[model samples]
Target chain A: MQKVIQFLILRINFIIFLFFEILALILYFSNNPYQGAAFFNSSNAISASMMDFSSNTRHYIELQDVNDKLAKENAKLRFLLSSKIVQNDISNRIKNDTSTIKKFNYIPAKVINNSTDKYKNFITINKGSADSIAVGMGVVCFDGIVGKVKSCSKNYATITSVLHQDMLISSKLKRIGAIGALRWDGNNAQMAKLFYIPRHLEVKKGDTIVSSEHNSVFPEGEMVGRVTSINIKGDENFYTINVRLSTDFNKLSYVYVIKNKFKIEQDSLESLNNLGKNESK
Target chain B: MKANDIVKTALSFMIFVIFHVLIVKYFVIGSVGLCFFYLGFLLTLSLSIPIPLLLLISFLVGFFVDLFYDTPGIHTFASVAIMFLRPKIITLLTPLGGYDEIDEITISSMGVRWFITYTLILLVFHTLIVFLMEASGFSYFHWTLSKVFCTTIFTTFMICSFQYLLFTPKS
Candidate 1:
């Protein structure tokens, strides 16, 4: 009887092991990461409290990296609000003399977790649905573009990092004005490639890339990256320019969502124009 | 069966989870982080967490670690595989100096060499799961080789160092 009980206990333990492991596998393949996200969120409150207690009790050298990231973001904010530099204006040369400032609302949130080393990477932010952060909004850390929101529940949203292949940002060279889709080829974390640039447009190494006005997602002239090199060949149809992202992607912490006040109105006009073009066809 | 054992296990698990949250998730240094995150494996192997409980905690720890990193299922697979292999590790590393089954795992009891060997086995086992899952398959031979080499070196050094820190000297 004793031997049978011990065997039954061992088998039960194995069954439990299989159950938890299988649960994890099922989560991996499932379309719903939000389920796991929810579990983490609930546990975070408890874990964070525990860490607050324990981390203080332990010796940690990792604090330096977080400090460095914070310092860079602080420097970036100072530059953004600095009024010393003259605005670069090709158009409205006379109107540029009007010193009146335009006010734009900004939302700030810290990135609790993010990833850039995979074929697909996501970012978990401290802000949530209640914070007015919604789907399709753009996230920017430092002066560079981060990524767009993919999913949002009540208290959190999963942002697809710019490192992911699924991400798309309309970007252009600051000097040449040549526009293309800025994306990653699933290789390096610090590098991305600009595609669809016409050969006629002059692109050179060390040129700056910026978000275009046409992209309602971002304000025009926001710095995206610098053109590290351009691959131009006789056979290729597009000039693929390699970009070195200005913001250190690995150390991202704080970010602000680029919410355009005119997005709703601009989107309606664009849809209307597309509908008319379709009707004529 | 002692109450102290249960408390120790719970405390260790909580520490590993917190380590995942504030440190490993936010800060990364070229996959060197697979080291600190392996604290879960170290915690499991260092003590005699019953095999069933070991697998359960390992799976949760792995899954949670992967979740924070935006990885799907890689952490869970790696952790559970190591958790399953830990009993064999304990037996392999059982002290020739002492015949008694040591309930508590500490450097004072196991010594540095045994600890290193023990950690190396768990790290290799844990790292293999991570490499295989991340590499996906053997289709890209070069990638598989790199991932294997990278994970092995990284986990071995990391797990051993963590063990050294956790075990306080009795003197």
Candidate 2:
């Protein structure tokens, strides 16, 4: 013990350094990607405002198109509301529907920051703490499901864009109920991969895919993209499907933050079930 | 001690964070990418700072990069490792009969080969630290191979190109 103490004192800094490093490694493997992003979370408002101002120039055109799209959607929504029976039927169908398990509420906002050339992709939005934007919310632009909520600040929050390498989405085919996980290969912005789908199911080109309702990030049936190619890698038991994204992420201006009230309940229940199964074994 | 150094450190830290965030969150080339992007934090720091401040600055630099990149302690761990090993890397590249402590160093003064060699060695160390941190002990061999090959090559290119573009060449 005396010799060990002397040796430790000789390299106290080194020991402390190694100690801190090991702590960091433990945190790294713990699956909390939000660990170190807490620093420099605040950026100068001047740079942010300047960025927002520059975005407004390109946003004017999107506004006009957005107005047209909103008008069309409004007209449809109004028509449905005007018919009480139709409204009742839609609500009843939603209540009775058992295929999809995910639920969501969307809060609309404008994109403040966007980048595409990097490995991890994130988008900053104008709405944040004040707008009740929290970490873990899902962000979806007109194109499709963009990504999950990463971090939140007073006036802003970052969303993990689907174009990111860390992007993982629960998705399924619209025509067939086959479900899988969605990920990007960091090669092309136009393409992503849908893996873990069993090969027994019949999948084809141009098949529409959407959120699988597996998690509370996005509502089920939200558009993802269409399958462009499929490869079965020599009895791997899963079909690798290449997907072309629907949302033109490069030209994104506005998005909606999806909130799920049932997320907590659902996650806890799932975890409990998993734990129960593990204990049983 | 100078105001310029302080401001430079703060500004550079932010840029490094943004660069790291973009790559990890957006460009994520996977295991290969995690290594390259994480190096941006350290490479940016080592470029302009005084040498004696290495261990202190490198520790904080690693910590800061780890924070922004969401890699937990990977940045902190790797950076400190490099800080300790930086002296050795410099020693290896020191021409025969020449000896200079790390404190007396900058990019322009060092010839191109020496500079590149210096940064490459640091980058290689940085990559090893990061790749190991990311790899969940699931499949060690494949992860180790991919991490080393992909990061060594990719980080070399990125570090070289970025340093070339950002720094002013001396006459």
Candidate 3:
């Protein structure tokens, strides 16, 4: 008994070190900040307040850029509104019924913290569950798609930025409707790769990429990026195409959280269809 | 450690943490190189600090850093690892006779060559663990290697410069 006690006492340092090492590893492995609790992340009250203060300080320095972008976006929105009005007038005349259900609600939120340099970058916004912002909701800036809401607290939420390695945006070439998956290559912050587009399809540089209707997270036809380069290997069936992202993640200030009204219903219906197929098989 | 030494260490701990979270966090040299100046606090601690206490302090400091970076355990894991290996490294790099009267590991106290070697070994390990865990795989092997190399150099330069500029040897 005495020998055992002495042995344990002598190796206590190693034992303690092992304990903390294990604890830290557990936290690391379990840290899926996107799906897990928001306590340890920037969405927590204390960190969010610090981020808010820092962002407020930075806001003034970026005022000119923000104003310019907002003005340009305003002109685009005005054009869109004019065309939408014309379509609405024609539809109204064809159908006397006035009921038109709203599909998406945009909740405006200010970005409090953002990073574009890391392998997996995330953005923190100043609105959360309190503002009806929930996980999996699509976030978009005026220029292009931002990301999806990963987790939320009462007053802050973190977004898995488009630069993240694991983030895959379902996108299609606007010119020819060639569908592909857009993902960051973990190197460039402004460029992403479009995969699964077959080599036979006609593709060219400067073609626009937009979000596809296949994903409920983002609305169809949302601008994603423009193709900068394309490579077609002799052996591979798919072309390796590079896209220049439209939204400058470094300058992200304000974004809108999109709430899809029929998301839950659509998901359930598709899941039920899959279940039936499985049972039959 | 003396009471005064403890107070100074604690004060420096706060300064390093705050500086790292606020200023150094944004000071990235290119996309690949990131300087983690918070490790400067652990690196310069009095050589006599016991392993258990050193480990605990590192864990706490790392946790504080992780809270702000939104990366929960990555920093804590790397910090505790370096602190745990610090004593072994000191013993390995001990002079022929011994450390003698040396109290802390700083460029002024340990000389430039010894300090560089010590800092390089520990910083490389620290950067390796951080980047590897961050990438979570060997998929980005080349990029991760470049990042590790650049970040180690960047962090070593930052820590060494801070030590040389700010730390005044005891009279």
- Pick by DockQ: which candidate is best? 3
Q: Write the residue-wise lDDT of candidate 2 on B67-119 in tens digits.
A: 76666667777787887676667668779869554332435556667767777
lDDT per prediction? 0.70, 0.73, 0.89
All predictions: root-mean-square deviation over Cα?
A: 21.2, 21.6, 20.0
Interface DockQ per candidate: 0.19, 0.20, 0.28
- For model 2, the superposed segments whose C-alpha errors exceed 4 Å read A1-46, A75-103, B1-171
Tens digits of lDDT, candidate 2, A1-281: 99999998887667756766676566665645443232223234566677778778768857887787678767876886689567667787556444333356679988878887788888888888888888898888766888888987777778888988877899999998888999988878889999998988999999999998787678888899999999998869999999998877787777899888777888899999999999999
Instruction: Kindly report which residue stretches of model 3 are placed more than 4 angstroms away from their true locations once superposed.
Output: A1-43, A96-101, B1-171
Which ten-residue region of model 3 chain A has the weakest summed lDDT?
A34-43
Better of 2 and 3 by TM-score: 3
TM-score on B-chain, cand. 2: 0.73
lDDT value for candidate 1? 0.70
Model 1 residue runs over 4 Å out of place are A1-104, B1-171
Q: What class would a CAPRI assessor give candidate 3's docking?
A: acceptable
**TM-score between model 3 and native:** 0.55
lDDT of 3 by residue, A1-281 (tens): 99999999999998998899898878886875542443355346777899899999998899998899889989999999999889988887676443224678889999999999999999999998999888999999998999999999888999999999999999999999989999999898899999999988999999999999888899898999999999987799999899999999989999999999888987899899999999999
Q: How high is the DockQ of candidate 2?
A: 0.20
| TM match of model 1 to true structure | 0.48
lDDT of 1 by residue, B36-145 (tens): 45454444443545677678777777766776767777777667776776776677766666446676665567676776677666776666666655554455666655
